[model samples]
Target: MDKILEAVVMSSYPNNVKQGLVRRVIEAAKQPMDSEQCWSMLELSTKLYLLGDTKYKREIGKEVLEVYGHYHPEEFEEFFNVRFLLSLLQEGYGPLGKRSHYVLDYIQLGLQFVLESPSANSIFGLLRIEVLRKVCERPSPKQCAKISKLLIQHPQCIPVGKHQVLFCQQLIRCIRQFQCVSEGEEDIMEFLEQVNKVSGLLQRIWRTQTSVILPSLKELFTIISSTETRNDLMYLVFLVTNIFIAGAHPCLAEEQEAPSNALASVVQFVPLELMDGVIRNLTNDDSITDVQMMTAIGR
Candidate 1:
């Protein structure tokens, strides 16, 4: 019985032949193998089949996932992490008729697994954030707004530190770009509020340091200058200036020094002429137009 099971596990046969052999082995066994033993055999068999033929791997992964799901939800991660799924995604498998739905479902299931596992939640969150960023490449206003809402709703789910700050900055840039293309002022305001809320959360988490906060602020200022809408650009400038002032306020009572360096970083990204223009605007003595803003950046 052990020899037969091993033979079946190691077999490199066509799908029909493999299925027939597996069925025959199951039927001939005097006693049923326990779940773990059965699953182990199945995993080995599936891997063998996948190795024999790359084209059949997705089918094999689907069958393996189904069997694993019957045994335990925890197996979802293992099954979904199969190299086939990643390969399929990289090879643009989604647009291939029925196969695309399978790929999409697998990706969604993988995300759901991540969301449900406490230990894996942050990993999953970062994965989702990356997916969202990819989706933003050519997204509609509606899609961008939806992604922004997801980020805002689960800011704390993202692990703290430089990566989280970088992700948030990317999200903010996406939202600002979406706003620029669509002229969505209300959406932009809502995104800003979300950023402020998340910044507050970071402050609570990383007291006495603006390490996370500074990157986000610099990105926000960059986006404001990048937006071509005259009114929106000026509004964002005003908003950021106010935020900077608030950061510097003595009455704020924070343990850390204000992030003066963050402001300098923002200024560095702005072209020298733009820096001059911004200073002029702050003094309320400049007549810088939108074209001048673009030209100031040598665009």
Candidate 2:
């Protein structure tokens, strides 16, 4: 048993470990291995050793950054794997509080890797959106600006995913909400300009045959309308109205406009009375609560 355990440990580190035997051993050990044991194994791995010391860690981090920073599609899977491992380590070290600075350092390193990589802009754009969703439960203006910049710079990078629209909508909603609270009109305007810029890029991508996984115009409209602020409503109206004037389909354009804005425009009109009627009905419904409102918009 002792010899077998030693062999397993030794084999685990060897580059040429027999896949069948390794799999069998790992499966057998799974039930008995506690967190400490698992961590010990991880620590013993070459990957962890590389991650442990500052100089070596930095070198690895630099390599990863180079891969991700340049928009290298070939390195996507490798970067994702490394990022996943780093995230796991970050989570593992969280209970240590301030002592977890090293974990954060590693995370920052991982981020740097993403930031410095060739295909980084898109990857970072996606990552920033995800990070913002969690960090911006109630975001600051700076965070909003940062996210806005990302969206503006790498609009096509945002892949079509279940959460993509929700993240975009949430970010816009948060920026609008922040604007309302702080009366930051300039900030709001800046954000809107970026949003519009990104929207235009998305439109161009939509029109192109060679476009990568860009979000559809309908998806953008869905997100814009789903945001949870009066200001967001106004902005949505503005965006839709502009898109309509740009010669997009009237129906699709009208979908994002506020009832008032839609009614005001002859080019793409919806009746104000009907809009008010819908709003009145929505207001009267107790089931249309705040949570429901967010859920509805998110959908």
Candidate 3:
């Protein structure tokens, strides 16, 4: 680990030359390493993945997909390095497609490896944060869901609650980029699945930090429950129910009309004090019904 860190963070050459972590990562990623060494470099790259651009960072290796390194230039390059490490695995039984599939499997495995690191609280935050950012960018739906769920479950590993929220937001944004029927059953179900993924995340983040989580939640939950075509009332019922069940604040910027009796029934059991900070956070949310205000006030 120290040797890998030295190669990445310490100057590998004399006179404190321009070469450092970025240079070393690119060099290491450009060529395949032995299995043991390759795995080490892959983990090192994951550690470095969450970093911002250093003063002299280089681009990723050519074999990696453009999207992996395109997010923020050098910081995301380690995603490429992870892929390169997977490429080094000596294939013994798989066809070309299966090999590619194994690479994805290994990358996912490597991410899990780092997330479980004992030092994650001290140093893995940025890396985990970056990996989530990349995972959100273009991973398949199941991969995105799986990784996001792991992230939500390991809030302690993330350390920074805001970063955890960022992961949720980015993943939601990426999911939105694909076409789903606006507030249709399928759309609602998919969004709720992600809601389930982040249920623990919100519990860990929302109550104490309403101010930090509200903005992203507004835009994200709005997209989930009240898309452009969401003209029905029942959908709002399901959406608010999911929010409350997740212990998240019900913040719907698009619920222009007062919620129907159906929606009110969904959230009736939730205590008002639990929701006060959330209501305060949504000062601009005129969409909140008078019933909601009274319900919280009555408590």
Best by TM-score: 3
Q: lDDT of each model, Cα atoms only?
A: 0.43, 0.40, 0.42
Candidate order (lDDT): 1, 3, 2
The better candidate by TM-score, 1 or 2, is: 1
Off by over 4 Å in 2: 1-129, 135-138, 155-159, 180-299
Query: Per-prediction TM-score, please?
Result: 0.37, 0.30, 0.39
lDDT of 2 at 169: 40
Lowest lDDT sum, 10 consecutive residues, model 3, at 56-65
Which tens-of-lDDT digit does each residue in 78-129 have in candidate 2? 4344445435433443343322334334344444434445655555554544
RMSD to the true structure for each prediction, in A, is: 14.6, 16.1, 15.4
User: Candidate 3 residues 1-299, lDDT tens each?
Assistant: 32644454545454246344445545445553444554454444433332213422212212122222332233333333433443333331133332233333334444433443343343344446444555455554344455545455554434355665676556445444432224566655664454344344444455556554555555444553442443333344454555455543232323434222112222333336746765566555778556544443332
Please write out the lDDT profile of model 1 over residues 170-239, one tens digit for every residue: 5455434332222266654544443344334334433433455445544554544443433322233443
Off by over 4 Å in 3: 1-126, 135-140, 153-162, 174-195, 198-200, 207-211, 221-227, 230-235, 238-274, 280-299
Better of 1 and 3 by lDDT: 1
